[model samples]
Target: MPSVQIKICGLTTREALDAAIAARADYCGFVFYPPSPRTLTPVAARDLADRAGARIGKVGLFVDPDDALLAQGVEAGSLDAIQLHGRETPARAAEVRARFGLPVWKAIPVTAAADIERAAEYREAADLILFDARTPKGALPGGMGLKFDWSLLAGYDSPIPWGLAGGLTPHNVCEAIRATRAPLVDTSSGVESAPGEKDIGKIAAFCAAVRSA
Candidate 1:
């Protein structure tokens, strides 16, 4: 089996970032969404980003962000990619990519096979499409520890590069990979001890699980 890529998202502390790096994660994500418990200010993000410095790919996660928000987040985080976890149209995704000149990942909430098919809409607009579980009304877009049916992606042909997210814990991540054959897997709450709290042990375990799979 091909090696799977791992992204540990919603990192809010130096210790957490260090744990992710030490565990050999390919990507480290910083949340820019205000309402999420994992949210970080540009200044705070900058500290973590500066410390990260080429050790791992830094990603900035945002909701339906405007250009100004994106600009601040990208500049401060020195983000390698922008992950949009909101209701952005394909045009907006393309616009973000053009304006920022960075790889753009649009998160699609999956509830059914049709949701997987919707990824085609972002083929031209985004650098990658992330399939995550759909949250309930008024809940956070992701990092909810909720997962969709992985079988929905079985034998599914993606129009562009893609990744998997939502509700993945170290215990189940191996099975998740086997079910979807996903090239990349992302997690946030799965490695946390509580809301917005990153557990170093969990982070290591999750990465090891992905590699073992």
Candidate 2:
């Protein structure tokens, strides 16, 4: 099997960014949602993305942002990909890709078998699909720090590239990967000291687990 790719999300500080880079994370995600504790301003995100350089891909995480906000992120000049973590439709995903000229990663929340089945509808619209744990009925969109049953993804196949996210920590990331054989894994709260605070040690440990897996 190919090596699993690791993406450390919700990075807000230079220290955290440095830690992710040192750990050789395949992707570093910046939250653009204002409600998220990990949220960053376009300027702040640009700085971190610039510091990230080309060693690792910089991902802009958005939740139903408007065209103006999305354009600001693209103009920031550090994002290599855009991750839609909201209820955007396939047409919206296609529009975002065309407008920004960047690879788009559509996040699909999976809590039941049917959720995985819906991924097929986005195969042609998104460049990649991220399977995340579904939020509670009245909760926020992504980064809920909850996990769905890994068994739901067993033997899963799709034409578009895909990834796994939600509640992934160093302790269980390997098991998650082992069970689903996900090519890419995304983490937010799992590597944080607090809701929005990223722990460098945890970042390194998480990456180590991915590499070992």
Candidate 3:
């Protein structure tokens, strides 16, 4: 299996953070959206980031947040990247990048082939585009453990750096990677004991699965 970058998202505990570090995940994601089960405040996220101590990429996940919230998260968490998981327009993404001088990653929900094409409009605005499974309306933005058709990404072309998310578990990540040829993969509920509760063993196993793929 070729090397695949891994991101453990929705981490809210130091134990889980340590597991990600030990497992050599490329990114550590902290949700800033209040409604998420794994959401963290800037202050708490700051402490976790400090504990991570440059061992991993610290990503601050937001949902159509304002400038003030973005500033606060960056200041407190020392974020390495900003993930826009809401219905943020391309112009807004560019604006945030200009204002914060941090790498911007846009989360695009995919239920149809056309949704994947949406990344074209964000080429200049975001450094990364994460394609995730589309959830039912009124559900949480992500971490619902839903997955899109991997065949949709077979030989897929992306305008920017990209990753796969949603419904990825240790059992299927290898198939997902092989099918999509995704260079990076992100998981939250996939390695969790419950919503917002990460399982260290699963975390380690998932990373190993990616490596073995």
Candidate 4:
């Protein structure tokens, strides 16, 4: 299976960021969307990102943000990459990557096999693809810890560097990796004690689970 990369997403506190780096996470993600409980202001994210330094890649998660927010994330958050978790078109993803000069990761909400097939639309435009569980109508985009069928991705040929995301926890992450042979795994609410609360022990355990898988 080679080595699996892990991203601890929606980190809002310095403690969580420190925990992620201490646990050897491959990427540390910050949410920029205001509707989320884990949302962080650009200045706060920048402080944490700077503190993290180059030890872990810093990723900013956005849900169809305008250019103003992107500017703040770029100039302040010091993000290494941008994650678009919205209804962004392939062309919109490409444009963001070109204009921002940062790697663009497009999140595809999967509810069925046909949903996974839609990844091909961003094959050429996005630098990476993330498959997350599709939430109920009127729900927030992601970070809900809602999991899709892991088997939906079994033996699937992903168009770009890709990952399996929704509802991953330390208890079941290994099964997810084995089921889909995921190259990367991302988690937000799964390791939390409560909404926006990152548990250090859970963070460490989740990373360990990925390595063991």
Q: State which candidate has the highest TM-score.
A: 1
Candidate 1, superposed: residue stretches over 4 Å from native:
none
Q: Sort by lDDT, best first.
A: 1, 3, 4, 2
Candidate 4 residues lying further than 4 Å off, grouped into runs, are none
User: Whose TM-score is higher: candidate 1's or candidate 2's?
Assistant: 1
Residue pairs in clash, model 2: none
> Which digits, one per residue and each the tens of the lDDT, describe model 1 over residues 42-113?
899999999999999999999999999999999999999999999999999999999999999999999998
Best by lDDT: 1
- Candidate 2 lDDT at 138 equals 68
Error of 2 at 34 (Å): 0.2
Query: What RMSD does each model have against the real structure?
Result: 0.6, 0.9, 0.9, 0.7
* Candidate 1: residue 17 lDDT (0-100): 98
lDDT agreement of model 1 with the native: 0.96
Ten consecutive residues with minimal summed lDDT in candidate 2?
Answer: 70-79
Residues 1-213, model 4: lDDT tens digits: 689999999998889999999999999998998889999987798799889989999889999989989889877778899999999999999999999999999999999999999999999899999999999888989988899999999998876899999999999999999999999999999999998999999999999999999
Note the residue pairs that clash in candidate 3.
Answer: none
Q: Which clashing pairs does model 4 show? A: none
**Each prediction's TM-score against the native?**
0.99, 0.97, 0.98, 0.98
